[model samples]
Target: MKKRRRDLIQLSILVVLGAAVILSLVLPQLPGRGRELQPLELSVIFREADTALWSNTRLGMEQAAGDLGAELRFLTLTRTGDGAEQTELLRREADGGAGALVVVPADPENLKLQLSETVGSCPVVSIESPLEGAGLVVAPDNEALGRELAEAVLEDWRGGMVLLLDTAVGSTGVAARLDGAEAVLTAAGVPVFRQTAAPGRLAAGLRVLSSVQKAEAIMAFDPYATEQTIRAVEAGGLGQLVYGVGVSTYVVGALERGSAAAVAAWSDYAAGYLAAEGAIRLARGEAYTAEELPFTVVRGEDIYEADNQKLLFPVTS
Candidate 1:
């Protein structure tokens, strides 16, 4: 009887030890143990490498990602026309477990459908270009931007013709900008002529733009077009004044050199941050939606102002 009792006690001890070992091994993964949360996976796609025009937006995304404990995957398509590349990247990221997506679409309209079919369930945020299928889009008010620039031209009331230039092969947003600017210019009786420039064809654009009389004011819809206009001016000055819609490091030089009168700078950082945050919220089943980032018409002197200084110098990291 004594031997049997000792054996029974030993068995109980062994069972207790085994249970404790199992619990120790498993408890950390259970809900009650530590309750730690993991970071989410987020991704972003750009038409090309990050630039001064996109630095603010990228920084904004980084800030939001850090705050939200998300990992950001940034991809750039270097080719001149790579809309298809963007769609493929979208598929690859989604398949590889990206919970949310943010993109500056190479072809905004075509990417819209591809995004829906490939990652339709994932919450998507469109950066500068608005996507029809995205859950939320963060973009500057381009119409307001165009209107503001035109108003500035009206204030100066330069008698020379106003020239509008855009390189969007198929962009709806450019149309909105043109409409807004034209509305103001036509109302004020500013003569306007528009031309589309092929990529790396500034000379051809110049030849196309040539007229008997020089233009009074020129509006370039995007930064590239603006740079071409600047290059054209450097090669052979065309208009009396120039205005552009986006910000680039070169913009500072343009303003200093008096090549560009002013540029309607969009809150690119806000666009990046808000789009990322909003997409995350949507992915997490929150009630997040589309938002419009603000814009500012900045000139050479305006760069000295506190707000304009930040816009002039943005932190990307």
Candidate 2:
């Protein structure tokens, strides 16, 4: 009897030990591991151009990095949009031995090639605009955004001319949004007037807005472009006739003033935060995938409220 009892106790101890080993292996996969998250180093390289937007994005990234106890390096190659400058910065960071890199390349074509040669072995992620064959990418569903914008236009104006404002025709993000918008509009048998702006010219957006003969709505690809269109329409005394669709504080203000009809905005803060998270995951020798943060469409009275202010990144405004 004594021998049997001792055997039973030993077997129970073995079972408990086995269970603990299994738990340790599966705990990280469970939600909120709550382990003392390790500190990580991440380099964020912005495109030489879009300084203001990059700054805003960096703020979010920094905040997230701080929360996650990670070190962040935010660098810009030039004040103006220069692909060569961005390429040089990427090369430098790679040589400096960063744990991970989050880059917004200036020129997709040239930067893609340079990145392939320079940072090919490193864990690199892209946001806003994706680099082809990147390890990770964070961007809105451009097609979905486009469809949402088109539907917003249809809701306000059923049969009038709708103008689509894009920064560049070849830009992957812009092209995707345009394609999505076009699909929805075509399905509804609505005509779309699309125009591409000159590189780095807000005036080009205004020019398109001014040139529209019977414009019912204007959908801008970015916040800055949206602001320019609003200014142009207001100056031309066409604010009442034209509806704007954009994502930014300025666009929200426009909506409050009844100038912008709707704005589809992604969480810049969340993207920045997630970018930092991805960097840390990469640093931990863990494989990670690109992901998109949640997005919201702000319009009507919600644009002016304090609660709705979350839509705008803290860094931008």
Candidate 3:
């Protein structure tokens, strides 16, 4: 009888132990007991100063940071395309304990080297342009953007001289765009003349070029260049149809005014969101598949269409 009683007690204890073990495994995943993740500090470094051009992108990033329970800091270079400045900022952020970083590299080659030495184990994501060593790159296919802009120009093109405005002349992004544009225009047998200049001075260069060479159509590779072309065309009374990439108030206004022919733009907002999300994922050691960013060509006639408006103007509230 005593032996049987002891065995019964032992079995009762074993059953209780099993039940406790099962509860331990299940309780953490229960509705009210889910694990809480601490917010991470993320830093975003831009190649240039903050401007209206970045508003939509910034909004998207801010929203993502909020949604993902992360802190975000935005830093920009005082001078555009200052690779050294960008590199220094990267070092500073990493040393300052930034959980992750998103960069728009001003000089990819130099930054690529710097990133290897400076960032240690922190994850990095790049946007706008490519940095070879970044953990991820979130940007539209720049070459495709250029091709679409070229096609837009050819829609009404009767073929004369088409001027290719090379804004930010030496950038990898711009170079890719130029390649795509040139390929399309050359294949069509359109006479293409190229002009290279910095963003702020592109309009002046355009005016000077127009004085000596008459072109039937102008293709600007970036927002500032496109806006400058519109201003140069309108203020100088030069009658050249303009097409380009990017969206800003100036570019959109030009489109509405019919001074600009067409603009190729992607959801910069989406680019921003993806960059933030990627940084967080990489930081957490989570696996991520890069999302493809698609582009759209907006013309004056369809600028107000719901889809285009959603891209150009997002409801950040």
Candidate 4:
């Protein structure tokens, strides 16, 4: 009996020692128990600062930084959205120890050479606009977005005058949208009449709207065109369905009130999320490839749905 007790005590002592050794090996790596993650720094550079449009993007980058256990530094140029300014900003960011970069080239074509020289070996992602020689990109296909809008409108209207209100100085993506819209409408045997005006030129848009004598459905490229045409139609007693490429409180209200049909644009929040994720991956010595984001269309009927609400009003999209 004494021998049995001695053996049992020895076994108990061994078990305790084994547990102590295991804890010593595992406890040092537990983050919650005091160890902290290595915080990586990432940068998101935009062409310009538009809070209404880019608020969601900021939220998205914040979330991505959290998810990736990294930090985000957002940078933007003035309202001009100039390529030269963006190039200068890129140089500064690269010199600032930015582990990775995500940029929206104001003028991709013009800044191609500058980008090549500045980006160097660091991982760079492009959003909003494609940069020449940029391997990784994430943006909505403007042509596809335009085609989606045109297809949606074609279901109701046919073989009539379709008015397209666009900006006089449009970006490349905007031109792609216009091209897609015209191609689709033309193929469907509908005639498209386009009128151009500059941004912040409400009177110019309204003047163009007044000149559109007859239009079955009216589409606009920029927010100014969209909002101005909708306002003109309502005030002047012009009965025409309006659609466009942006969404705001006014646009959503218009959609609900039957003054607007639908609007198409890339979810800016999603853009930020994807861009941050890509930056994190690249910073971690991972690879990336360029791809186009999907287009989103919000109409009056399902605008209130949970998923749509998340996409449309996520940080005021």
Q: Which lDDT values do the candidates have, in the order given?
A: 0.75, 0.68, 0.82, 0.74
Question: Arrange candidates by lDDT, highest first: which order?
Answer: 3, 1, 4, 2
Q: What is the C-alpha lDDT profile of model 3 across 112-191, one tens digit per residue?
A: 88788888799999887777778898877889888888888778899688988776643577678878989998899888
lDDT of 2 at 136: 75
TM-score (all chains, Cα) for each model: 0.82, 0.75, 0.83, 0.73
> For residues 1-317, could you state the per-residue lDDT of candidate 4 as single tens digits?
99999999999999999999999999887775542445777877776545454676777878888888988888876753566777788778877778788887767776677667776766678776566765577778878888888887897785679987665242566667777888999999898888775444443345454546678788876544576667777776677888887766777788899888888856777778888888888777777654687767778896898877876787532
Can you tell me which runs of candidate 3 are displaced by over 4 Å?
Answer: 1-38, 203-205, 210-213
Q: CA lDDT of 18 in candidate 2?
A: 100
Q: Report the C-alpha lDDT of model 1 over 1-317, residue by residue, as the tens digit.
A: 99999999999999999999999999888984552455678888876543445676778888988887788888877654377788888889987888898887768878877876788688788776678888887777778778998887888774878878756655566556767888999999888887666535663456455641457777777665676677676567554577887777777788888888888886667777888888777877889866576788888878779988777686564
Give me the displacement of residue 221 in model 4, in angstroms. Answer: 3.7
In model 1, state the lDDT of residue 10.
Answer: 100
Error of 3 at 124 (Å): 1.2
Q: What lDDT tens digits, residue by residue, belong to model 2 across residues 1-317? A: 99999999999999999999999999877774643454566888875455565455677788877776778887876544466777788778887887788886556677688777887566777776777756778887877887887777777775676777765453576577777877887788877777766435553446444546566676776655666677777766665333433355566667777877777777776677777777777766688776565566677677546655656635342
lDDT of model number 3: 0.82
lDDT of 4: 0.74
> Ten-residue segment with the worst summed lDDT in candidate 2?
239-248
Give the poorly placed runs of model 2, Cα more than 4 Å off. Answer: 1-41, 48-50, 54-56, 77-81, 208-210, 240-246, 304-307, 313-317
